[model samples]
Target: MTGSREALPDVDGSGLTLGDRAAIALTEYRNGNHQALGELVREATPLLWHTVRAQGVEHDAAEDVVQSTWVALVRHAETIAEPKAVLKWLLVTAKRAAWEAVRKHRDDEKRRTELPDDSPEHPTSLPAKDPLPDAQVLSDERDRILWSSLQQLPRRCQELLRLVSLADRPDYRYISAAIGMPMGSIGSTRGRCLAKLRTILDEQGDFSWT
Candidate 1:
């Protein structure tokens, strides 16, 4: 049930997608190998974070949802019915939890707004905030521009691109399922999204993303 925000390990040449590794991790955990679960946590937490964040959950609540998703995986390790689909399971669980959090926040805000204006609990002013803390820290102007351009895309495109960037290309089907996208067309959809992103970047300036 432990996790970290460390960068994903390079699995190039291993012939294993994140989905495959998730299945292996769950199977190993079921067989009393706890280390695999920890490795999965370290590797997959970023994916979970972004998945939750894409649901419009705030940063702090997204952190809680990600951790709870890992905990739920451990609790249901024996009854998941299909270990091969563990990555999709995690993404779905995190997304549902995020939706719940957003719903609860909206309910609370609604209640607050209904309160009397002079109520002690009523805020006097809206709070200012910085950008989301989980946003990638840009190292230069080009990186910043690329990130800005990314934000200009549709939310679905943003979610797809972020998940694919953090995972193996072979896992796109799992990601597509998690994000409610049609599996058969995810490849073409991703290609179109990338082309659109490149077009946006080009409009910004001649900056090499490579």
Candidate 2:
């Protein structure tokens, strides 16, 4: 008992992105801090969850696909060229993974057709198909109108506005990271995007950003 080791103090590792933490933890794992890698996986899951769902993968399959994406991340962590760029890589990877899940669903349907009633293909073939009555449809139509307006901007403007609009991170680091630009440029980009958005709305004849 006299020679027992002392316990370590707990530390909260905040102010970091999941990708940044994952990259650091991955380096730690390579250097022998095995437990840290697990922490990275847990932290990064939510981002992947949102991204996968955003890509139209249903909740359950998106969960599985995201888990597999992390597993793959661990395996490929060493190959990432720039740790600073990890979030974009993760997003792109999640999008690709989500699409892959969708492709698998389609393939499963094709195979089930070949195999008959024993295992009728996965039920995720159709996206959420809840029917909305007239009022609900009009409301949805309004949202679509706004979304379509955003898309009508030039490609750069569209990407920049989407970068700002879709981000939940208020720190701006995440948006800067996603867009591969300096943090200082984000505000200007956002302004230009807003102007373009307003112009699009004004030109629409029936809508106005005001």
Candidate 3:
């Protein structure tokens, strides 16, 4: 699924956080409003993909995990006890799925290593190194610089910043649950992350992010 960072909607004035929309979406889906769920998927897929990838799942596996997460949501819609926590549920579910994928991959690698080499060795097929769908959207010089700067931060900071960028409005409660960060520290952590990013950008020379 191709997406442009530039195309992410500005929801600052909407008076509704992504988490809020997620709750409404879940409630609507449970009431048979399937289109609401579809809309939520489009808005939230990027966040889910990043959340999965942050768990160390590879791109292909991350895609599968994200898809399965949505499917899981559908399957458990009626059973979800808190519609308001739907966003956190999705994040946690995707994260667990990603961990399972990583574990399975390690197991497969171990099994391959244990197999006896009775026949001629065959060349291993490497997955194609395709640019990530969202990465492809960073064609603009500023966007490229910003992304590179993000990479320079610590892994947790990178994950936090990416998640914050994807959300309409950062919901610290859900973000904390998703990333295993302290609920009270998310805001300050994000501030420090942004400060570090800005410092990196400043060293690269002044470029307005605003």
In terms of TM-score, the best-performing candidate is 1
lDDT-superior candidate, 1 or 2: 1
Give the per-residue lDDT digits (tens) of candidate 1, residues 1-210.
Answer: 223212233435477888888977887788799998899999999999988877777778779999999999999998887777889999889888988998887677766666557354554322233254344567578878878888888868888998889999888878887688887789999988888999999999877778
Could you tell me every candidate's TM-score relative to the true structure? 0.79, 0.51, 0.78
Ranking by TM-score: 1, 3, 2
What digit string (tens of lDDT, one per residue) describes model 3 on residues 62-176?
8999999999999998888777778999988988888889888767765677545423343122233324537567877788888778778997998888888788656767877
TM-score of 3: 0.78
What TM-score does structure 2 among the candidates reach?
0.51
TM-score of 1: 0.79
Top lDDT hit: 1
Q: List the residue pairs that clash in candidate 2.
A: none
The 10-residue segment of model 2 with minimum total lDDT is: 1-10
Q: Model 3: which residue pairs collide? A: none
